[model samples]
Target: MSPQGHPWQKQPDWRILDTQFGSGNTFLATWLTWLEDADHPRLLHYVAVCQQPCSASELIKHFEAHPKLASLALELSHHWFGLLPGFHRFLLEQGQVVLTLCVGEPLPMLRAQQFEADAIELTLPHTCQDELSWFLKAIAHCCRRGTRLVMRHADAAETPGWPRVLTQCGFTLEPMKSDGDDSYRQKPSSFSGYFDPAWTLQRTRPTTKTGPLPVLRCAVIGAGLAGAAVATSLARRGWQVTVLDQAETPAAGASGLPVGLVLPHVSSDDCTLSRLSRAGVRMMLQQVSELLNVNRDWAPSGVFERQIGGTPKLPLTWSSEGTQWSANGHPDGDVALGSGLWHPKGAWIKPAALVKAWLNQPGITFLGNAAVTDVRRQGPTWVLSNNSSEMLCEAECVVFANANGAFELLQKMKHSALDTQAQESHLPSKQGMLGLLSWALHAEPEEARFAPFPVNGAGSIVSCVPTENGLTWFMGSSYQPDAQLERSDQENHLRNLEHLKELLPSLAQKLAPVFEAGTLHAWKGTRCITADRLPVVGPLDATDQPSLWICAGMGSRGLSFSVLCAELLVARMGAEPWPIEAKLARSLEALRA
Candidate 1:
């Protein structure tokens, strides 16, 4: 179906076919209809014959200008622009809806293709021309025995007695609804063609169970952002949840950082990670802000990323406009704002505070210092233990939220096959060091607010955040080997100062004396990454083990990807629609299991 409206508008259970796609109106209407109805269709095949195929760029620009159709039009234009001819499919609503876009001459394409569709839409011109007859014939051949065709007549004279034509083609018409005045009288017809009465007409009855449903008790091994989010989601859905953390408090790992950046880590053509990160950021900001009153420390400050060392221009946001700007700039572009990129949406959050908020709710149990060194299943329940042979927790479902620690646990389970295939190393220069920097001259308190910078610099990301001691200037986000975790603070601080000088020379010059005097304090945290540089969030496999899940490898975009990953796991557990496309969800799942 043409994506004129939202694809989830009407849900169906069979394939869908579309012949004409002018402005994708009928296609979008059907898509939106399918989206609204949960059981609309299992598969949707959209075919359009465009003799004059408009450039995706031009179509998007046109859609942006319209009022009523602007939103839906922009969405469709994005999908179209992202399309590459040949059968391309997208999994929506957790594989419930599969969208197949076929760009070519619809009549010939339909004739060559053989798929049973529950619905078909034709947006033909007013006259019953030869082309229309050919298109109708092709559509008839493609429609299965029970297919429903929704055709829109351009004019009254063009309404070529479809009832008779359909009857001749072995289709029985069932008039549904009509819109328009007597003079215009444009009517819509629904027909069940050559359908199996047993399959289409039969009412489904619920299966009678012989036993009671099993109780679902889930445990999350980390209480950081990802674990907290996942546990909260499961708890909200009526699952008994227990959150375990080795630290005294949650978010004490890499997530313990005072502040973290929240923005879509986008790419040129919207890869799986880029798309999920974009959607994840949006969903996180919306849900987090609503669930907790922690907005004070979490303000949406836009991220300013610049290409270093003559790298190709990076997109400022994850939108078609951002991609165009980056592509058009070629080797060098000052910078461009993304289409859906909102600075307010990509805010800074106190990680620990957020995690604590998630644990404060009912139905969630927080257990600190309850490290699990081993996991074994006892029938349907999973049991965890510590090094001292003490029982940690028991549950039907278990999720691993520890970053690098996840690998160790999986290895212990003899399921080392679940190891992340690739790992990334950030050049130490890219790491940031945060500290408190006293102004050369003490000014009014209002001047202490954090100021946005156009490029990476030595200035603290959370300069505005004040503590009883003084204004905090966080720096030294430099990348170091995970093994360097034991390195001294002084060494890391000097490295961070060097990087600071590169980003802002003036700041280095002004702080030279302070640096020499060791007046600058520093902390270091290594950003964990996968070989593919994407997060791993979903089920884990263990030989004869009870339910096991994992939510890790968030890297530096934790604030942006964490909450959404939690939502994905929750949806998977509840068998509900995923917040992201199905392909993306699978892409983030741990590969081995």
Candidate 2:
């Protein structure tokens, strides 16, 4: 089938065999076709002969060159990179479509593999005209009665040869009308390729499964950035969600910071964490903009990443080709600074405002000061309890969204073992403090938005963000094991001022006139961390206990990972296809479960 044809046009259990795979175009086209069809094939076994397997790096380069195919190509490239030798399989749509890639000589490999196909597609390479007879013979040997073989013959003379070969093999040839026009036949060189047919045929057998569909209703225990996002997604997918928080208002935890920054978690190469974060950041910004008007409460100001002298340890490695830098001259001749893609789409969002927007949706319910004291399964439904020793709520599914609270609950349930044994540890801890300062800036809010700063300095890193109240300067976002939430206005002001002085010595020297007379307001909150330093978002099953779900431990990148994690959880509920990929959705699930 061509890229334009639908793979679901055929029978559900029909096996497809392809002779030639170039640039993986046919495979991609087939995958797209399957996505569009309602009753997709049960199994898709793609057998193609490739002289050389495309390297992971080269696949990425090709995707970069072709902007139109970038999204699909990049996803395929990621899968290709993860492939191992021998038979490799990927389950799509809950195992309805199984893509099996055979990476060797097609004719010999097909003979050795114990599988029969309902249809065979033979793509003759542009350079293999002399070997066409042998290829056709091999294909004929593989086909049985009722098998449909679609062969691509470029020249008119080869059409006669094809029919003759089919007759010799005790098969009948049907001369269907060609798809192209007279002009297409007149200008052979101008034709893009051969005809691609979309036909339907019955499968020889049906594929069967042993288990029933997993149905669940979940709860997210926090209404902060991570919890609110997760709840919104679950509710959108028809899951009953009740958001519980000890605070009077949503986003009263670390997400209480007046303005949270949105930046990708940088890492070397395209590892699982790096890829998930990159995609998560883009998805978060897009969802925020769509749910809440952008540039009003949420606006993405380009981030300025600077290194004054030594090489800095970046969360993600710099992609030399992917980065976008300013052409203007640098302020300091001694510094060699460069800027990469920070998501022109990335933005600073008012966490509280965003949470309220998500909860405003119909299916979501918010319960404040619920303070969950216990969570355990009561029959098939999970029950929640408060300090009063009374049942707070019950649902078929449950999610632990309160960061520290979730950790404590897991410990009590003895389900902590499931998380500790995973590849990416999910143990929680207190890591940092985000302090917000109310400052009177000399410059306009727009001008202050893009001001450059030293993010990795010895003192607290500060940045100016525009809010309805006024221009707010954020500083003293320190990481420590024992830092507590400090609400004292005077102490916060003095700490921010001292930290600002250490960051910009020249400005501090000239700021005596402004600092001595300037008024300030400040507040502090603690950030939660995970053992592997990545957010935990998915289903959990404790030893000898009923299943529980989680969506927490987002750390500083809560704004970046929250929405994506939510969408992932929603898709797991099996309501509909999410905007993100299936593999990524499963990646976020609790691996041990």
By TM-score, who's the top model here? Answer: 1
Residue range 413-480, candidate 1, lDDT tens digits = 63233332221112111222122222222234533322352233233334444444554556556565
CA lDDT of every candidate: 0.55, 0.54
**lDDT of candidate 2 over 411-444, digit per residue (tens):** 6662322343342344444344344443554455
Q: Least accurate stretch of 10 residues (summed lDDT) in model 2?
A: 184-193
* List of clashing residue pairs for candidate 2: 217-397, 266-315, 266-316, 267-315, 267-316, 300-347
Q: With candidate 1 superimposed using the best TM-score fit, by how many Å does residue 217's alpha carbon deviate from the native?
A: 1.6
Angstrom error at residue 345, model 2: 4.4
Question: TM-score of the candidate numbered 2?
Answer: 0.58
